[model samples]
Target: MLAESIVIIGVNHKTAPVAVREKLAFSGDCAGPLLTLMDIDGCRECCFLSTCNRVEVIFVASDPAVAAVAVRGFLFAKSGLGDAEAQQYSYLYQGKEAVAHLYNVAASLDSMVVGEPQILGQLKQAYRDAVEQKTTGVILNRLLHKSFSVAKRVRTETNIGGSAVSISYAAVQLAKKIFGSLQDKAVLLVGAGEMAELAAEHLVRQGIGRVIVANRTLERAAKLARKFNGTAVGLAELTTQLAEVDILVSSTGATDLILRKDEVKPLMRQRKNRPLFLIDIAVPRDLDPEINDLDNVYLYDIDDLKNVVDVNKAEREKEALRAEGIVAEEVVKFGLWLEGMELAPTITAIRQKANAIREVEVAKTLGIMKSLTENERRSVEMLANAIVNKLLHEPMIFLKNSTPHDNPQLKLAFIRQMFGLDKESPEQQPPRENV
Candidate 1:
C-alpha cells in the first residue's frame, strides 16, 4: 500500500512549451529543492529531477493528494502561473502509474529524442543530490535504484541506442560511411550555430584530424572553434578553407545559399578532386543541392539527414516497445514486493503472539507436574509448538494469497484486530494507510 503512495508531478516537453519549462526548471544543486520537498507535510521520501526537457518531483507521501498539490505549487513558484494554469500545463501520476512513468523516463522512452542518453545521467545526478541531502528513504531508494537497473537492461537487451537519431548525428554517420574512417579527416563547420556545433562535436569525437569553423562574424566562429581546439576563419575564407577539409557541414541563417555549386566546383579541382562530403542542415538551405552533381562531391541537405533519422527512429520505436514490456514486468515485480510489505507486519505480530502464549502455557504445565522427567517436559514443550504452528498455518495462507478478488488491507486489519495485536503494543501496530 506504500507503493500506492508514490507520486510524480511535473511538466515535460509534451505537457509544456519551452518558455514555461525554462521558467520552472531548477538549476545548480538539488539540495535546496530536495530539502523543500522533504519539508512538505506527509512527503515521506523524495527525489528531484530537472533537465532541459523535463522537471519532475518523485516522492512517496502519506497524503498523496495534498503533497501533489504542494509540489505543483512549488514547481510553478517562479513561473508566474496561477495554480489553475499550472495544473493545466503540468502532469501528475500516482501509485503504479508513477512507478511506470519513472521507469519510462529512466529508460529514455519519454525523452524528446527517445533514445537520448543524457537524461539518465541527469537523473542519476538528481538522485545523488537527494541522497546527499538525506531526502530519500526506503521506498525512494529502492525505486530509484530499480529504475537505473531497468534502464541498463533496456540498453543491453535492445538496440535502442545503436543508431543515429538526430540530424547532427545522422550527418556524422553519413560522413563516416563516405570516408570509411574519420581519423585522418578534416571537417569545416559553416555557420557556428547549434546544429553545426553539434556536428563538429560528433566529428571531433570520431577522431577527425582537424576542425575549421567559418561564420559571418569571426568572433562567434572563433568561440565555437576553440571548443574543439580547431581553427576559426571568416566567411570570406570559405573557398580557401573548402579546399582543405574533407567534410563540410553548413547550417547558417542566411537567406540565400552560402556555398553555391560554382563556388565549390573549382575547389574540387584545387584538391585534385578528393572526395568531399557536404551536409546542409540549415532551414533555407545554405549549401546548393546541385553540389551533389559534382564528381566525387557528396551533398546531403536537412531533409536527407532527416530521412536517415526517420529510418533510425523507426528502429528505436520497435526497440522501445520491447523496453516497455521490460518496464511492465519490473513494475509487477515491485508491486509484489510492496504487497509483501503490506502482509509482513501482521504476520510477524501473529507469530510473536502465538509463541508467547505457547511458552507460558508449556512452562505452567511443567511447573504443575514437578515429578515429570526432563524428557517429559521437552515432549510437552514440543506439543505446545506443534499446536501453535497448526493454529497459525491457515491465517498465514490467508495473508499470502493476495488475489485480485481479495482486499489485503481489510484482511490485515481484521487479523491484527482479531489477535489484539494493535492493543498489545503501540510499536507493533501496523502503519496506517488511507486505503
Candidate 2:
C-alpha cells in the first residue's frame, strides 16, 4: 500500500495576530476554488478551516514531504508574503503531529481563551464545506467524525467549557463595570450573529433589565430578540435606541465604522448625561474609537476585552489540562486506526491470492472427477473454501493484531511474499492516502 499522511499547515492566534489570520480567511465562495486548486496540485483529501483567530489547511497527501512544501507555497501566495515572513507566522505539523493539533483545535484547547465554544462550530462548518465540495474522502471523513466524538467527550468529561473565556464573555464583564450590576441595565446588541447573540445571552443570565437586538436584517434581529425575550430593531433604529440603552454591545460584519463620532455625539446628549458603556468586538470596530473621549461614555474594543479574558483564563488552565488528556487519548486511538487502515491493502491482496489458488485447485479436481454428480462437485468446492479459510485464519489474525509502527512496509512486503501475492497490482493496494 502506498503510504498516506496527514498534514496541517496553519496560522493561529498563537502563531500570528488576528490581522494575519483575517488576511488568510476564506469565505464560503472562495473555499471551493481554493480546495479545488489544491486538489489539482495533488492533495488527496483536504479541508480548509478558517475562523476569526485561525486559518488552517488540514489535508491527506500521497507524499507528506511534497504536500508540506506545496501547502507552504500556496499559503505564502495567499498571504502575499515572502518565504521568510510566511515561515515566521505559520506552523506546520505532519502525520501524528497533525492529528494531535487538529484534536486540540476541535477540543478548543488551542483557542485564544481555552474552552471557548465558537471554534468548534466554525470547524464543523469548514468540514461541511469540504464535504459539499466533494474534497473529503473516507479517511478524512472518519477522522473528522472521530474528532467530533473526541470534542464531545472533552466537553462532557471536563470543565473546560464551564468558564466564561471568550471575547464576548469579556464584553459582558465590561458591561458589569459600567452599571456596577447588570440586572438593572438596559442593553442594546448591535448585531444578531453568534458573537452578538452570545454577548446578549450572557447579559440575560446576569439579569439585565431589557435587551434590544439590532441588525441589517429585521428578521434576524427579531429571531435573536425572541430567543432572549428582547425587542427587535432595524439597524436604522440604532440611533434612537441609543438613548434608551445603558449598555451597547457591537459585533457587526461591516467593513467600516458603523457608529461614528458624529452620530454618537448627539445620542450622549439625548441620554441626559447618563453613562453609556459600549463594547465593540467587531474586527474593524463597529463603534468609533473617538467616541471613547466623550463624557461618561466608556468604550472597549476587541483588544480591551482580551484583558478581561486574561483574568478568567487562569481558572480554565486546570480544566484545560484534563481536556488535553482527552485529546491525547483520542490522538492515539486515531493513530491506531490509521495504522490498521494502512495495512488493509496487503490483507486484501493476501485474501484475493488465497481465494484464487483455492479456485484453481478446486477446478482441477472437478475436471478429473468427471463422473461425479453436480452435487458432489459443489461439495468439493465447499471443502476447498473451508480449507482456504482455515489455512488463512491465523495469518489474518496476526496481520490485524500486529503493531504497524516498526517498518510497516517491510512487514507488508513479507506478508505479500509469503502469500505469493507480491504481483504489481495497484488496484489490490490499499486506498491512496495522498491524492
Candidate 3:
C-alpha cells in the first residue's frame, strides 16, 4: 500500500535545457511555500527536489490521476509554460515507476553526470526539508530512508563513487593547478550559497587555512562560516581581507559583480605580490573578468572547471555501467516488494468476505438447530470457518504473488466475481447514483 501511494512529476536536464531547468528550480529556501501552492486535496505527503540538472516533486496522493494533473498544472503555471510544452518536457510516474525513479536518482544513475556524488546530498536535503515542513508522511519517510540506505550501499559496495567524478572536486583540482599547494592558504568565500558552501568544504578538506565568508547578508555569511569552523566578515570588508586571502571562490546570486577589478587592484598592491587563486563558480560570475589580467592573480571560471569535468565524465560513464547493473538488480527487488504491497489489500478483502459468508451460513443453520446445546452450535461455527479458510487458502497465496503488470485487469475482475461484489462498489460509485 505504501509503495502504490507514490507519484512523481518532473523535468530534468535530459528533458530540458539549463534555461528551462533554472526557471523550474525550487532553490530549496522557498520550496515549502511552493509545495503549499501545489498541494491538492488528496495529496497527503509531498517533497520537492530541485538541483542544477532536475526539478521533481514526489508526493503521496489518494487519487494519482487527479494529483498528477494538478502537479503538472502547477509546474506549467509556475514556469509560464503552456500545457503542450510542459507535456513535451515533463514526465509523470506513479506507483512502482515513481519509486524506481527516486531510487535511481538517489543512487546517481539519473544524474546529468553519471556517478555525481552531489545528488545524494541534495536528495537528503530535500527529504529533510519536507520532514521539517511536516509534508512527509509514513510512506515518504520509509521511501526516503530506504533511498539513503540504497545510495550508501551503492557507494560503498561498488567502484562508482571511487571513480574520477564530481564537478566540485574538479573545481578544486583546477584551483590546485594555479596554486601548487593549498596548505596554509587563506581563502575568501564570497557567497553563503550552497555551491559556495560546498566549495568551502572542499577547500577546507584540502587543508586550506583561514577561510573567510563574505556575503551581502552578514547573517548568511556567518551561518556558512559556522558550518566550516571559519570566520565570517561583511562584504564591505572584502577589500581589506582580499590582500590577506590566497584563494577567492565566489558563487552569489547578485545581479552585478560583487568584486570588480578596480576594487581588487588596490588590494593587490597591498598584498606584496602573493599569488591569489580565484575560482568563479557562479553563473553570472561574482568576480570581474578583468581580475584575471592582474599580476600574480589567477582566475578560473565554471567553463575552465567544465573541461576537467568533461574528461572525468567519460571515465565516470565506464564505472556507471557497473553501477547501472547494481541499480537494475535493486530496482527489480523494490518492484517485487511494491507488487506484493498492492496485492495485500485485495487478499485481505477476499479473506474477510469469505469469513463473513461462512459466518452467515453457519448462523442460518444454527437457527434451525435451536434445540441443540449452545456448545454444539459454537463447535459447528468454528468448523465452518475453518472449512472456508482451507478452501480459499491456496487461491489467496496465488493472488498474493500475482502482479498488476502481469495481469492488470484480471486480478480486480477475479476478486469481484469471486466475492459477488460489484465491479464498482457503491462507495466508489458516482455521486449521481448515490443521489
Candidate 4:
C-alpha cells in the first residue's frame, strides 16, 4: 500500500525549542527543498512546510526508514547538529497517523495556539509550491486536498476559530494587561510582515491611540500603516520612535538582533523612564534578550505569548475537541479510500480470471458446433459474458464493502483460492494468447 508509507517528519514548538526550530526553518520558496527531497533514494512525493514555529516534511517514500533518516539529516544540516541530536528533537508520523496529523495541522488543532487560522494558509501555500514544482503526485494530491476539506469542515462545524487566540492576539492581550487600557497607548510595530499586521489589527480593535509601523522596506511599511491609518518609518528610526510609542512589537526577518540592550538603554532616559512593553515574535528574535533587563522595560518573546494564550484556552480546548472528532472521521474516510486502492489489483485479477475462463469455454463450444450460424455463435459468447458478470457481481460488492475489522489480505487470499486463481499449471490453464 503506497499510503502505508506516508510520513511526516519535522520539529515543532512542542518537540523543539525556538532556538532549534529557528535553525531548520526554510525562509524563501520551497523549490530547493522539494527538489532535494525528490533526489533522495526512496522519496516519491513530498511537500516542504516551514513556518515561524515549525518545519515539517510530508512525504511518501518507498523505503520509509531510510528516507526518514535522510530527511532528518537534511532538515538539520544547517543547524550543525548530528543525526542523533536531530532525531532527539524531531518527530515522525507514518501511515494513517501522518494523515491524521496533517488534518490536525490544517484545522489548527496542533498549533502553538490551537485554532489560529494562519497555519492553514501557510499549509495551502506549501501545497501550491509543491504542486507547481511537481513534487506532489496522486497520493499527496488526494491527501492534501482532503486535509483542506477536513479543515473547512471543522471550521464550519465548530466555533474553534471563532474564539481563537493567535500569537499576535496573545501579545496584544499581554500589552493590554500591562497598560490596563490600550485606548491611551501608542504602539510601535517594528516589522510590517504578517505577524506585525496581525498585531496591528488586534491593537486597532483594542482602540489603541496610535499605530506606528517600521520596516526595512519603507514602501511595505507605509502600505501596512495606511491600512490601519497609522504612521510608517524605516528601521533606522526605531530608537527615535521608541520615545513616542508605549508598546513595541518586533517581528522582523532579520538574521541578527535589530535592537540591542545598549541601543535601547539610552532611549529609556529620553522617554523619561516610562514603562515600555516590547513583544518580539520573530523566530531568530529581532530584539535582544538583554533588553528585558533594562529599567521600566518589559520584553516578551514568542514563547512568552504561550503563557498568555494558555489563560484563555479553556473555551478553545472544548472547540478543539470537536475539531479532533472531525479530523478522526476524515482520517477514517481517507483510510477506506486507500484500502480500496489496495483492493484494485486483486479486483482486476479476479475479473481477468473470470474473463479468461469465459473466453476458453466459449471458444471450445464454438469449435464443437462448427455448423452453427455466426449470429448464433455471437449470442452464445454474449451469454457466457453475461453469466460471468452475474456470478462475480456479488463477490465484487463484498470486496468493496471491506470494513476496518476485516483483514484485507486474508479476504483477498480466500477469494483467490475460492476461484482457483492461484493455480498456474500450464495444462490446467489456457495459453495467454488464446485467452
Candidate 5:
C-alpha cells in the first residue's frame, strides 16, 4: 500500500476566538477516548494538540479529503457547536500543506503572538500523549521528530525568539526599563488571568523578591500563587497590598476599572514618594487612564505593551522569512521520502521478476546438459545473477532518488506494464528477503 497523506483540521486563535478555541480544547483524559473514537481504517495515525490559543487534530490517512471531513465532524461532535458555528471557525489542510502547517506551528510561527516559547512545549506534550495512547504510527513518529529538529533549526538559525514579543513579556521588558532589574522588587499580580499568570512567570524568572496574587476569588488567586511560591489575597485587600508592592500587574475579566486614580493616590503618599509601576493588561482597560498623571507613578496599559509587541513582531517577521525557507526545504525532502517509499515495492517486484526468470532458465539449461561440470554450472549461475543485478542497478537508483512530483505512481504502473510484471500474482512478488 502507498504511504498515507497528512490531514490537519482545527481552529486557532486566528481562525476562531478564545471562546471557540476553548470549546474545542481537549484535556489529557479526553484525548485517549477521542483517539479511540477516531480510530478508523482510513486514518492510520493521529495526534491532538490543544492550548489556550489553538486546538488542532492531525492525522495520517489513506484519503486526506475523506479523513479531513471525518476529523472535522469528530471535532464538531466533541465541541457541541452547531453547524453554522462550526463551519465559521474550522480550517483544514491536506497533504504537504498540512505537514508544513505542523512544522510552522512547532516552530511557533503560527502563534497569535509569534515567537512565544510555550507552544513547542505544548506540542511535545501532545505528541507524548498520542504516543502513550497508541494513536500514532511510524509516519507520524517520523514527522513529529522532524518537527522537533525543524523547531530547533528555526530557533538557532533565526532570531525569532530573541526579544520579548508577547504582551506579558512586553510588560516584563517595560518593567526592566525602570528598575534595571526586578530582583529586589515586590510584584502584586492583580488577577489570576492567563496574561497575569504569564507576567507573574516572567517576574519569578527575573528573581523578584516577593509576589502577591490578588483576584476577586481568593481561591483562584491561591491556585496561581502556589505555582510561584507567592502569597494570595482578595481584591478587597488590594488597597493595603498596593501600598506594599513596587509593581502592580492586572489582567482581569471585569468590565469596570479595577484600580482608579482615587484608589492609588493614597498608596503613593504612604510610600514616601517611592515610584510605583503599573501594568493593566486587561481589555476594557482595568486601570483608569487618569492614573498615568499621578506623581511618582508610572502606568502602562495594554496598548503600550502592544506597541512594544509591534516592534518585536516586525523584527520577528524578518526572521520568519528565513524560517519559511527552511520549512519549504524540509517539506520537499519529506515529500521525496514519502514518494520514494511508494515506488520501492515496484523496484522489488521487477527485480524478483528478473531473478525468477533467470532461475528457471538456468535450471532448465543445466538439467538438459547433464554432462556439464559442476564448476561450469556454478559459473553460469553467477553470470545470471550478475546480469540481473547490473540490469536493475540504474532503475533502483532512480526510484530511490525520485519524488512525488515525478509522477512516481504512474512510473511504477508503466514499469509493471512494460515488464509484464502485472501477470504475476502478489504472492509471487511477495516481499523479497533483504540481502
Candidate 6:
C-alpha cells in the first residue's frame, strides 16, 4: 500500500533566539544519541541540522502528528524550555508544506539573511552527520539529495546567492568599519569549526596578520591552524592569548562563556585598552554578555550582527518574490507526485480486481461451451479483457489527476473497500499505468 511520508518538524532563527537554539543544537558527538531517540516507534528516518542560526530535526514518519509532537517535546525537554515557550515560538509543517519549507531552507530562501550561502554547507554537514550515524534511510537520503539539487538549481538559475549576505561576511565588513584597515590586525579564532574557519578565511583575505586557532582538541585546532599558517593552542590558555589578539571571533560549542568579563578585564589592562573587537558567534556564546560593559572591549553577539544582516536582507527581499515564485512552482510539482503516490495502490488493486473477475468469467464460459470452436473462445477472452480495460480507463485517469486537497488517500481507500480489493487477491495483477 502507498504510505504518507514526509518531514515533520523544524526550528530556526524565525522560531527561536540563539540562546534557545543553542540549547537544542546537536553536536557531532550527540548525533548518535539523537538518532537513537528519533528511531523510536513512529519515526522512520531522521536528520538533525544544527548551525548558529538554526536547530532543526527533519524526519520521515508514518504519523506526522505523532512524530511532530514527539520531536517538539524532545526539543523542549532538552533545551530546558517550558511547553508554553515551545508552543509560542515553534512552527510545525507536514507533507508538501514541510517539503517546501526544507527546499527553501536548503536554497537559502528562508535564511535570516536571504540568499546567504552558508546554510547549504550547514545542511550538507547535517546530512553527513546523519549518514555517519546510520540514521538516514532511503527516504531521507533521497529527500536530502533532491533538496541539494534544488538548492543548486536555485543558486545557478537565479541571482539569489550571487551576492554575499552572510553574517560572517558582515562581520568582516563591520570589522573594517571599526578599523580603517585590517592589514595589521591580529585575529584570534577560538574554535576550529566551520564558522570560525569561514570568518578566519574572510579576515585573512582582507590581509589580516597572524591568525590563531584555539580549541579543546589540539589536533583539530592544529589542523585549522596549519590551513591558515597560524598558531594553535589549547583552549585553557585562551585567556593568556587574549591580550595580544586585536580581533577575537569565538564560536566554540562550549555551554558556558569562555571569555567572562573578569577574564577580559585584565586582558584590557595588559593591552592598554587597544580597542579589542570581539565577535561571539556561538550559541551559548563564547564571550560573556557582560563583556560589552568592559572598557575597550567591543562585543557583538548573533543579534548584534542583525543590523548588518538586515541591510542585506532588505536588498534580497526584492529578488525574493521571484525566488518564491520558483519555489511555488517546484512545490506544486512535488505535490502532484505526492498525490499520485496516494492513488498508486488503489489503482493497482482496481486493475487486479477487474482482471480477476474477467479471468473467472472467461473460464466459466469456456467450460460451459466446450463444443464451441477455438476461435470463438479466443474472441470471447479478448472481448472480456477489452471490456475490463475500457471500464477502468476513466477511474485510472481520475486517480492520476486527483490532488491532496481532494483527500486522495481517503478516496482511494474507499474505492478499495467498495471493490473488495482492500485485501490481497491470489490472482492479483500489476498496475497497468505507470505513476
Clash totals in order: 0, 3, 0, 0, 0, 0
Error of 1 at 89 (Å): 2.8
What value of lDDT does candidate 6 attain over all alpha carbons? 0.78
Q: How high is each candidate's TM-score?
A: 0.69, 0.54, 0.51, 0.55, 0.58, 0.50
The CA lDDT at 256 in model 4 is: 93
Q: Indicate the residue-level lDDT of 258 in model 3.
A: 81
Identify the leading candidate in terms of TM-score.
1
Model 6, range 232-278, lDDT digits (tens) per residue?
99988888888888899999899887778887888888899789899
**RMSD of candidate 6 to true structure, Å:** 15.7
lDDT of each: 0.88, 0.80, 0.77, 0.87, 0.81, 0.78
For model 3, residues 28-102, the per-residue Cα lDDT tens digits are: 494564467346878878888878788888988877778777887776666888877898888888877887788
Worst 10 residues of 4 by lDDT: 426-435
Per-residue lDDT tens digits of candidate 2, residues 1-435? 232478888888899887776767566564664555466455778888876788788887777777777777776566787777887899988877888888899988898767878888988988888888878876677788777878888887888877566777667766665677777789999888888888878888889999999999999999889998989999999889998889888988999898888888888788998999988889887888999999999999888878767766776898888888888887887776566455776687677888889989998998889999989989999999999999889888877776645544446556766766534334333346552
Badly placed stretches (over 4 Å) of model 1 are: 80-82, 179-181, 190-195, 213-227, 232-244, 250-275, 281-297, 343-435
Worst 10 residues of 3 by lDDT: 426-435
Q: Across residues 1-435, which tens digit of lDDT does each residue of candidate 4 receive?
A: 756789999899999999998888688878999999999998988999999988999998889999999999899989999999998999999999999999999999999878889899999999999999999876788799889988988887898876426577777767766888889889998888998888889889989999989999999999999999988898899888998899998888889999899998998999899899999999999999999999999999988887666655877888889999899998988886566445787788789988888989999999999998989999999999899999999999988897888755557656766877545344334237531
Order the candidate numbers by TM-score, best to worst. Answer: 1, 5, 4, 2, 3, 6
TM-score of model 5 relative to the true fold? Answer: 0.58
Candidate 3 residue 432 Cα shift, in angstroms, is 66
Model 5: which ten-residue window has the lowest total lDDT? 422-431
The residue ranges of model 6 lying beyond 4 angstroms of the native Cα positions read: 1-5, 166-200, 203-315, 343-435
Residue 14 Cα positional deviation in candidate 4, in Å, after optimal superposition:
0.6
